[model samples]
Target: MNKFPNKIFDIVQEDLMAVEKELYSIIQSPVNLVNDISVHLVQAGGKRLRPALYLLCARGGNPDPSSELLPMAVAIELIHMATLVHDDVIDNADTRRGRPTANARWGNHSSVLTGDYLWAKAFSAIATGAKQNMLKILTDVISNMCEGEIIQLQEAFNAEQDEADYRLRVAQKTADFIAASCELGALTGGMDNRDVMQVREYGYAIGMAFQITDDILDITASAEQLGKPVGNDLRQGIVTLPAIYALKTSTHREELRRIIVNQNMSNDDVRRGLEILYETDAVEYSYTQVSKYLQHARNSLPITLNGPVREALLSIADFVGLRKY
Candidate 1:
């Protein structure tokens, strides 16, 4: 598998390989289709940032992570995969990670069931190897993720949705899972409560910034770079940070609002909206917000976090802030 040469990933290379092996082994099933779909998603390219964070946090506490750490990382990644499958179904998406989504390849019924299977497998692994507190944190993250999805659906096409609501939704949908990964890893690795909290806060900040950057990419990145349709969120009536900022500050707010509310906006309409967004510098504005969160993430790290692992964590934060994909 190809790995990014980012300093963070280099430091945790062996642990990440262990995570890959665990992910492959844990998803096996007697039923061929189940194994096929599960493996297919696993083989599909992803950064595996959450698992890396988990492993890195573990390393922060102990140079050689306990055997349980790998399984925990696998479970965290499985939870993430489960969500992506369900999200594709909800979005009626055709592709993800430059390949056909499970929902697109297998029918919604099968896809939904496969996602459930992943969730079951994830929880099963967690129950066997992780502490009760870690399980509770994972459970809460899942709940918050569901709530975030619901909020997005509820507020879809509502042009008046404010920044506060957007931030809350981002926190629940993306930040919580990232936070749990760090917290659980830190706890399992024998970090004190204070250090665990610090890492969790760091994860939350980066997670928020990550999602904001994703939203920005949906506007600015090409379809090839995004591995899915660009402007999809807008097409689905999901108002994002750029649109929100543009609506508040741009002279083209009325036009943007009209286009957004229109259920049948064409590609040209989305392009026009993009033009307005660029004119208002909404993308830059949103990027500024991302920078603030990145700074917060760095600030959340304890001073004792100063070795190579700490540097890796800090570099990961920088990558999240600046990554194009």
Candidate 2:
């Protein structure tokens, strides 16, 4: 547990419990398997970052707890969870958060159907308020996320992935979710166009930073800390920022590429590949790159935001950079 400077960290547990209860209620279905699969993954839990973004964005305008806001939080969480379930299937990951993945436990067919079910459930929640503009935005964000994943698969281990390509992919796949969460928050809080755009920009920058840090951690963090296997991205053949950096800058780039490209590498081969990344300081270099985005995120906040809420958002940007794993 990182000691977060923001008070949101203090209240995060309580808010998550609330969100979880609400999520459970919304997931109720006539089909027991869909309900079971969704709830299992939901309760298995991870950082509820998207919902927190939604809540913070809502609080920025009006600190009051509203019915609409809770549903929006739930919607964001379901979308996030749905993504995770689908991602594990795509990655063929056996475990997540130290437990068998939904795809592993319930089979890929069930997990895929469950993910689709949650997506529908999330849209139904969004439709409760049914702002056509908001729906359009959410739809666009989801579409972009899918496209990002597709592009990532296409680019995997190409040895030619650039900063621009990586940034664009992460922005759509990762940042869009955060942006949607923040935008939805502002929308429910009655923000105008300027504030909404500001929050969206803030989310995009921070989300990019977050994913970059995740890439670094994949190389640097221990499996215990990561709650999944280390080098998970590399294992999937998806080269992230650090891997791309090492490919460009490391003296051992050819050897590393050989290990990955040849496929069927042993654990020792993966270890050496990781060691090459460390020798070249790719992890540290990746952190430096992420810091630039974190700063950009801080600068993106609306001038109107100040006080604890402002500080909380800033702390979130920092937290994204500083996560140990």
Candidate 3:
């Protein structure tokens, strides 16, 4: 963000800070354990990308949207936080953003309940003032996220998973929520239906690109860079785009399939799988997909949008397609 679009955030840094302050205030709980656990998770920190994207889109439609849109922005973040908490539990993931996850620090029962608490709070915060349409978007996205997770679990270590399958999971698990964030932000900012739809698709494109880039990084990046084990997705038996591509194009296709289906993958299996990915140019192929989505994101931006906000959106799209972390 510092390199890509810090200036935009710099202009609204106070808004983001206010979000953090307000978030901390919301996480306060009567139960000591609840407070401690939720606070610990919040303090672990995140990209805050959902809220940031929400704010940017809100600002694009209304210059002074921060005061009015604060609740929705915070709700978006809360939902994101809730989803991550649940995801860590589902994946049994130990770390997120280089720190122990809530599921790692607390037991699954505690973490799951805490995630439910967050989700309830998120809806409670928005249910009072937000429009019916906005409420529907959040509810739908939450359902989609759950469905996506279920699909991923069912397809674990599925070497037969194709590009279509990969895309379906990406759309449900990641892209749809991102699109909703932008749309909700635009609605909060007072954009018309047409413009809102444009930005919605824009967010969808970037969201897809972002997840693909993440999956690419999973295989190609280091644990230190990722703040978790490299190849974590593969290690979890989650097949992504690069692996799916390699399974088709690699000369060692059968070997790659063998590695993917192997429930107990050794270090050698992971290494060999990566070799097939690189050897088949699967990484580069995945990059091409990122580029395509990014281009669509740019194309989908509202034509009437001009000036810094538009530029900020473009910069973010670029960052999503090219980020190292």
Candidate 2 lDDT over residue span 79-184, tens digit each: 8888889999998989887788998889999999889988998988777665788778788888889999999888876767777888889988998888888888
Cα TM-score of candidate 1: 0.96
Output the worst ten-in-a-row residue range by lDDT, candidate 1.
1-10
Candidate 3 global TM-score: 0.95
For model 3, the run of ten residues with the poorest summed lDDT: 1-10
Query: Using Cα atoms with residue i matched to residue i, what is each candidate's TM-score against the true structure?
Result: 0.96, 0.93, 0.95
- Global CA lDDT of candidate 1, please? 0.87
TM-score of 2: 0.93
Count backbone overlaps in model 3.
Answer: 0
Note the residue pairs that clash in candidate 3.
none
Cα lDDT of model 3 by residue, 1-325, tens digit: 1134466566456778888888888888999888988898778777677888888898888745344677888898989989899999998899887889888888899999999999988887787788898899899998999999999999998899999999999999999999999999888888889999999999999899989998999988878878788888877789999999989988899998988888899988888788888898889999999999999999999988788889888888877876877
Q: After the best TM-score superposition of candidate 3, give how far the Cα of residue 76 lies from its true spot, in angstroms.
A: 0.7
For all predictions, the C-alpha RMSD in Å is: 1.8, 2.2, 1.8
Per-residue lDDT of model 1, residues 174-238, tens digit only? 99899888888777767888999999999999999999999999988888888899899999889
Candidate 2 Cα misplacement greater than 4 A, ranges:
1-6, 9-16, 63-67
